[model samples]
Target: MFKFLHISLLLFGAVFATCARAESVLFLNPGSTQEAFWVSYSQFMQAAARDLGIDLRILYAQRQPEVTLAQARLALQGGDRPDYLVFVNEQYVAPQILRMASDSGVKLFIVNSALTPNQQALVADRADRVGSLVPNDEEGGYLMMKELIRLHPPVAPGKSIDLLAFSGLKITPAAQLREKGMQRALAEHPQVRLRQLVYGGWTQQRAYEQAKQLLVRYPDVSLVWAANDEMAFGAMRAVSEVGKEPGKDVLFSAVNTSPEALQAMVDGRLSALLGGHFTLGGWALVELHDHARGVDLNQYGGRDRQIPLLQLIDREYARRMLAMGATPDYGVHFRKLSAKGRPVSYRYPFNLQTLMR
Candidate 1:
């Protein structure tokens, strides 16, 4: 009787441990289903969640702030509240979500778009706020502009390289950071005269229309810098409509790893493309998985981890990426990227090289 009772207790403990290992993560995607960048981002994250044995749920906000808030409220208030919530600071709506999640006891992790310093102050005391994983947007912006300037050297000695810039919404933190980086690069190169900087609203149509008007307004603009791929493509179209060659007459540079952008790079239409930050959501999953398994996330990079995930996708690299196709097989051993059982010195391989490997 004593032996049987001991065995039953052991089985109960084993079951409890298994249950503890299971965790659910809710991802609030800030883009529509048809949006290429966000769709790819969620796909990569789903692959990671599968490998880590995490139950991941995604809710799209269709790029609307009100929809995002509404979906978040529904998810949080539902009887089946997720154990963790991963979100982006899209259009400056993170604070409200953070407060809602904190009140409901759901651990929060911000990805892609991180909170500003002032926004962080609002939830500084919330221990349930896990951390943030964001790319160095400013670095990405600065690099894209620097390359554009390099590719389009002045026609004459001391000639101003006229440029037209397309930025996203000013209220978005990511857009603000990217613009800040562009400004830094512009400041360094005094001859690169920015004729005008207009908000493209992150849509190809709006960017196309804006480009049409801006191109005519600034005909001497030899350089065009867009904050994203869609806007870049729009600007390219506008350049072509205006009887100027895209890659030849007016050089273009932008961010994001959409297949269209990669193919454009291959075709020599896009002068520069910086990307690979879509893996942020996947990397965040790895961190959360390790944290759930008793790994101290603080040892890696503390609460707010800003990683240099963006890299310049040259022609050769662009070809390699394109070969992988639209829904590229991530083929990543997500567990290998975790810090759960690794040494203290083990660094997380969170870059394009990892994806290529």
Candidate 2:
């Protein structure tokens, strides 16, 4: 085990050995666990929690900001004081949620979504905050588009490739950041024309309906980009139903390489997928564990650290990830898995490492 994690575990052992009370964590998920995005996140966290001997409670906001706020309030009012509050900021509820955690003096850790500039400044000096963990979404967006352009070169004599985008909720920060990245790529490539962009609310069914409408409106669209894999899957179905081959006549690209989506990429259905973000929630719990065990991640570093993305540009990488399967055990690298834990890296960099099996 790394020195910092070893010290953390020693502290945890010493404290629990005397107290014998289990540590509890409250996770405020922005979406439902039934969704592919949340399903992977929750599953990984569950595995990590079981190994860490921590009591974990997950509350879904159903993609509603108000529901998140209500659930957060209800959790705070309960008898047990959550040692850590692991949350995702959606609908701009970060300020209120942070305020609640700050007033209650609970350790706060954010996942999936980054805080606004103002919110970050507010918590910059707070000792109870462990910072946010987010995927390189902007970079993921840029890479997907860049790969698409590489695969399908522009036609000669100033011919342009028409493009359409299926975005998540416009209000979500992750969606906005991804769109900005897409726009940046588009700006660089004048040969790619963006016909239209629509919000799919981060769901496949919604994306399917919206993509069908967009395809009808602009049947000449050449490429369809989705903010997430589920939406990409939906867009592929719509493109196929409209009598167009997904990877041939029209192309598809997205982020978050779910199992089905990764297999689809290997099968030539999706063009590109940048994944490994499903570990955000689980990783946050790991950080929180260290923080609760007397390791000051604050003294160690700042917030909004970016975890590296897994780019499955071809079948080889997709097959490697598929072999890793559902229960990702990346936590073992950070925490001691046995009496003798493996060497770990405590420095939280944006692109820490390539998460391959």
TM-score of every candidate relative to the true structure: 0.93, 0.87
Write the residue-wise lDDT of candidate 2 on 171-253 in tens digits.
Answer: 88888888888899999999899998889888899999888898999898878888998888888888899899988888888
| TM-score for candidate 2, residues paired by index | 0.87
CA lDDT, every model vs. true structure: 0.88, 0.76
- Consecutive 10-residue window with the lowest summed lDDT within model 1: 322-331
Error of 2 at 138 (Å): 1.3
Best by lDDT: 1
Off by over 4 Å in 2: 1-21, 121-124, 299-303, 310-313, 326-333, 337-357
Candidate 1, position 118, lDDT: 84
RMSD of each: 3.2, 6.2
